[model samples]
Target: MDMEQSRQKRSFAPRALPHEEYFAPGHRGCQGCGPALAFRHILKALGPNTVVAEATGCGEIISSPYPQSSWRVPWIHTAFENTAATAAGIEVAYKVLMRKGRIPEERINVVAMAGDGGTGDIGLQALSGALERGHDFIYVCYDNEAYMNTGMQRSGLTPFGAFTTTSPAGKVSKGQSTWKKDVPAIAAAHHIPYVATACISYMSDLYRKILRAAEARGPAYLHVLAPCPTGWRYPSEKTIEIGRMAVRSGVFNLYEIVDGKKRLTVKVRERLPVSEYIKAQGRFRHLTDEDIAYIQRRVYEEYEALLAEAAQI
Candidate 1:
């Protein structure tokens, strides 16, 4: 094969196919909801021996209505701000149950699932405590960049220029003027065993991270970039495509922090301009050329900084 063809083939790694579906279909998730896909990947990776603790968010709401649930495994519903605490309790209880001979000693992974609102904003304390206490569980944050389940309100993880109901763009101000909070960095700060960022477009990258989190973990964290159609003001069918663009445009850099080392998982050798990503969504419509240029510069700077930091380690 030609060098160019080989390099092109290397751009995307083939998906590591899953064996079983822990999340059954026929739920209320909007078409192309990225978190729904993330949940499926997480379930596919964790398997039947997993216990999920979910916060009151889109995933729990859409997947589990009164008399029905999408989860095939044991699932516990927790408050929006207490999923990590609930998962920590489950971990401790599982140990106690094992000691009493009620359950096998083999580990049954407990995963705390939440949205960006629950993770970076309300549930930060619970997550911090769980990680600091060394809970043997994975905390999954399916961040759509807003409080989408509630009312598309802004959250701490929202990017600098994204529009939301609360942080709406106007003549006086741009939407969400602050930087996106680095949740994985916060998890890494706790000196956890594993911390990673994953997106739906890269299923294999996400699956490996999920499996690794489930298989071997001490306060592992997976921050997933879930694109929301309603909140993001994009077509439902473009979810996966937009996710791919986000990564390719360097809006979201996929990486993992393991044992104090940072590694970039997927690299777009020649990144697409950030405009190619923002132009598709109405959320960024208010951004002027100067605004976009500023954001583009910031994005590339951060991407380069990440590369330099990874290289040093």
Candidate 2:
């Protein structure tokens, strides 16, 4: 084997495969779908007694089909705007059942999962309500940055200057001009027990975050950067690589907010230009040199701000 391959083999830590599969393989998702992988890792950490409340998006459709379903756990598909509400209800039900000795308190963990559009936009209010109410559950946003299931449309979480169906680049416009919403920061503002941002590229870190979130006493939110190959217009095999590039370019930082304190979990060893990350995906193909420069500036500024926040902690 080559030196690089030898080094990789030495550094690799095999993950303990979970015997209970929450998501079966029969359902359809695009090749190299990050959300599918995210679910698998999440289930590995959460185990079999967990119940999932999924919103209307790629996750729901891909896991449920007529008489057949991919989810091995108890799953509920709710409206696009009500994932948090549904999860809150399930949590309340679990508490009541446990109190009445109708169900074992340790038997289940409730989790709410949604895509960026569903969590960052449509379900934001419900999520905020659940957190403010101190619901005992975990809310996970598998963010691919846009509404991937709905034809790659722009959502509030779509990054600045990225092209989507709703924010197409043209002679008069230059893709999405606004910045991506800081959903984890917003969740932190709610003063919940825990909030963290993770990416699928770091499987071990992501798994640990999910496990922590599940064990927390009150409401917890995990915002995961799950790449969508089809939506980003990238080759299926490049999904993990693209996700890694996003973090290394400062476009996405992996961090955790515990009890209102910010902490940086993964630091980029060698930062690359934002254009290098954008160029890998066809969604940003229409961007001009000026646009790429603007994005790079914004990414650096955001990374610096995160560093400052971490410093304050």
Candidate 3:
């Protein structure tokens, strides 16, 4: 990036918009695709000297086509299940190359990017291995909540009571049966140095987490809550609003786990009802009043549990 571009990226003023453009405009992503915005902020924090390993998902689909590309940095294309493994190899190769005097001492940040389906389901084993081996890299999972690229299929990260092609709400059944997988908590269990949750609407928070992950020595995991307009059945314009509602409703808590402490960054002391959040999306439109009440209880229970965990920290 140029000097002016650099200044724009580093600008942290809450009101002033970021001038630097890392992901670049014009891509195959649908209107109001949440991952598109998340990728933009991620590249801003990592800067130019970064090696990326993106899995076979929306991030790879929309950005890096065979003949053309969207990424301005050195990026490698990897399979859905081995994105973390590929990134680990790259990180090792970089360090070895540096020691052998083949490369400069300037640190080259390594990041593995994947969608929730890749990271939480097919890619889980490879991700666990990379973290367990203590690779110096950051793994970013942009969670659109389901397998959006192919069809609106339910994945491990898909929330309960949400309608999907695979989990359609029928006369005898509700939507998705299981709760969303707690990927961040799973990452924390690996004893990683840094793990955080970010939403696409909150650009500043997302940028901060990316930088934190980049600076960490060992494996770092950043789970981003990127809303899917097409899959979630919401209007394109309400993408940012839905994201904010997720956080404010305490449904998608924006918290960071650092130095063994879990602190809620965006505090919702008197959180809005889960109904307010569910009613905004078409995926949850089939939910009944009783279903909404159950969801609200689950949300409150999870938030309280997080508070208890934070207290111990």
Candidate 4:
């Protein structure tokens, strides 16, 4: 076989993603909802022995509605700001039960799920406490860049130049006046055993990260960028495409921090111009050339800084 042929074959090798479905179909999620995809892969990685505490957000509203639920595992509905606290309590309770011979001592992957608003904004205090107290659970933040469940309101995790109900672009100001909050960095600040960033567009990477997070001895955080077609004003079919564009354009970089050391999971050797990502979404349609250029520059600086930082360890 030729060297080129061999390289191509290796590049296209199939991934061994679990076929078991934990997130059932027929939910109310909008077409191409990235969080829905993230949940499926997350559960696949964690397997059946998992308990999820979901915040009152898009995932919660869609997956659970009164008499019906899409989750096949033990799921708890939590308030927007107390998801992590709930998960922490569950983890502690499980330990106590095992100690008292009330429940089996088998490992149970405790997961706290929330949207960006719930994680970076309203739930920050509760999440911080859970992490600081060294809870043995996984916290997954499905960041679609806004309070999408309530109303496409602006969130701290929303990138600059993206329009939303609260941070709408107008003649007076550009959308999202500030840069996106670095939630992964904040999670790492707690010196947790594991912290990582993932995206639905990259399922294999996300799956591997979840597996690692589940195995962490204490306080693992996974921040996943779930592009929202409804909020971003893009076609539902373009969800995966846009997510890939975001990663390739350096709008989001996939990485993991293990025990205070950082490393990139998906390296962007030749980054696509940020315009490729921005121009595709209506939220960024109003951005002028100068605004895009500024954002592009910031993306470059941040990407480079991360590369350098990750290289140190």
Off by over 4 Å in 4: 1-15
Which parts of model 1 have CA positions greater than 4 angstroms off? 1-16
Worst 10 residues of 2 by lDDT: 3-12
- Rank candidates, TM-score, best first: 4, 3, 2, 1
**Per-residue lDDT for 128-194 in model 3, tens only?**
9999999999999999999999888999999999999999999987999999999998889899999
- Going through the candidates in the order shown, the clash numbers are 0, 0, 0, 0
Model 3 Cα RMSD, 1 decimal:
2.6
lDDT of each: 0.88, 0.88, 0.88, 0.91
Better-scoring candidate (lDDT), 3 or 4: 4
- Model 1 weakest lDDT span, ten residues long: 3-12
Q: After superposition, how far is residue 74 of candidate 1 from its true place, in Å?
A: 0.7
Per-residue error for 42 in candidate 4, Å, reads 0.5
Residue 19, model 2: Cα distance from true site in angstroms: 4.4
For each candidate in turn, the TM-score is 0.94, 0.94, 0.94, 0.95
Candidate 3 CA-lDDT value: 0.88
For model 4, how does the per-residue alpha-carbon lDDT over 79-169 read when each residue is reduced to its tens digit?
A: 8899999999999999999999999899999999999999999999999999999999999999999999988999999899999999988
